[model samples]
Target: MPLDGQLSTLNRVYKDKDAQDVLEHALNNFGDMALVSSFGAESVVLLHMAAQINPDVPVLFIDTEMLFAETLEYQRDVAAQLGLTDVRAIRAKRETLFEKDNENLLHLHDTDACCALRKTEPLQRALQGFDGWVSGRKRVQGGDRQALEYFEIERPLGRLPRAKVNPLAHWDRDDLQDYIKAHNLPRHPLVAKGYPSVGCSPCTTKVKTGEDARAGRWRDQSKTECGIHFGANGAVRAS
Candidate 1:
């Protein structure tokens, strides 16, 4: 499908639909689709909704090897609790890390490079078989995401462009909180400790009072994302 045509169809069909409706459209339309989850704060809401729609949908979770142990545990717990049948753990190649970042201090000199290696590369490889994938990003997170849409397009490095579905693009914190509480979904352990957004341990810090929800990630740096969702400029053009 042409880019504008796809966008037109998506906007027309899902402009007023909810997150669950968006997931249903993606799952029904795409032969190969997966749900990418960080199992981070508020991640459970999407996971729970996906499980309700189809527990067998593949759920991709990237393990950067630098993530907190609690995240790993939470990944397991959430999948088990939701009865998610296909929770795939995507990881960076050991050899690549050994050769390029044996000291494990890449983030200090170059934050973008570290994320590209630990995150973007691995996810691209894992997604080769899928035509579209789901994300939990929302407009309320701010920054470049303030105008997020229900469905966008992404072209990962050296891979074919694919549809990126953000089911919760229109959802907010209170919507997520209420859904989780109503469904009794399990929360990521670190959220209670002040980490509104969780990622690799060394780079993630707690968001201070009155700070942006994502302010803690790469705390001192200008980097707002881990280079997985969008390009360096935080723009994903239609494919």
Candidate 2:
């Protein structure tokens, strides 16, 4: 199918129901589709939803080699409980890391470069051969993503452009919590410790009262995202 036709079909399906149904429909239509997960707070909801519909759908888990131990544990636990069959762990290339940025302090001086090496580069590689992928992003997450759409085109591996689906784009924080609670899904351990938004160990912190959930990630920095899902012209996608 042409990319435009695919986009139109996805948009029509996504407009028909809530996030979970859209996700299931996407997986049903595109058998090769996968879900990209960070396994952070509230991540299990989507993971469980995907598992319920199709346990064999590939679940791409990016292990940046800098995530919290609790996050890793939660990832494994959720995958097992949900019976997800294809939980592929994507990782950065050691040679690229050593040769490109030997100091390992690239994030401090150049976060974009560091993310390109650690997060974006690996994810781009993992997305190879996929027709499309799903993300847990919601509009309420704030930042430039405040006006997110259910479906958009993405350049897989940051090169070969393809359709990208955000099934939970319309869901809010309360909706997520309710889904998890109703399903009795396991929560990320750090959430109870006040870290509403979990990312890498070094970059994430606990959120303060009245602050946005994602404020803790890359605190005090101008950084909003790791730059993986942007356009070729360097425009960030709507959250």
Candidate 3:
């Protein structure tokens, strides 16, 4: 089926359904589906829900090599707590890193290029055999994602287009907090230190009291995303 048709059907069927329902439906429909998670502040909500439905579902975690030590530890702890047996840690190739960012300071001059070298490229390679994947993006996150849908298509770099499912597209911070509290899920360690949104170590900062949740990420930069999510026009919005 075409991308639009697939999106329309998926939205129609799972439109009013909650995140868990959308996830369950997607996992059953897309046999080779996987969950691509950052394991950031609110990642545990989706991970826990997925574990409840299918603990064996493939969960892909991108370790950008520049991520905070807390995030790395959280990834391991959350996976074990959720009993997610198929959590795969994807990393950037050493050769590619050496060629693109030999000094690891590429993010200082060009965050997009650094992300392309570390995140987008590696994820594209890791998703080779999957027909579809789920992301934890939410409309409340702001910017381009404010209009996010339950189902979409991601045109990743150097990879065939694949179905991208955003099960928590409509969820808000309160909804996530409630879910986590209800389930007794563990949160990323940095959350308490005011890092509402965690990404790479250098790029991520602490959000102030009145700032947006994601204001800390890539602070003082025009780059909103790390070149992973796709735009509505089927282009990779690598920034």
Q: lDDT: which is higher, 2 or 3?
A: 3
- Show the colliding residue pairs in model 3: 227-238
| Residue runs of model 1 more than 4 Å from their true location after superposition | 1-4, 231-239
Give a tens-digit lDDT track for model 1, residues 103-174: 999989998889989988898788888988999989998877888889887755656777888999999899
Clashing pairs in 1: none
The number of clashing residue pairs in model 2 is 3
Please give the CA lDDT of all the candidate structures: 0.86, 0.82, 0.87
Model 2 TM-score? 0.92
lDDT digits (tens) for residues 1-239 of candidate 2: 87757877778766768887788777877647879999989789889888889899999998888899999999999899999999999988889878987776777787677778888878878887887899888889877677777888775443656777888888888898889889988889999999998998988889989998988988888788877776546635223
Runs of candidate 2 exceeding 4 Å displacement: 156-158, 235-239
User: Which one wins on TM-score?
Assistant: 3
Judge candidate 2 against the unseen true structure and give its global Cα lDDT, from 0 to 1: 0.82
- TM-score against native, each model: 0.94, 0.92, 0.95
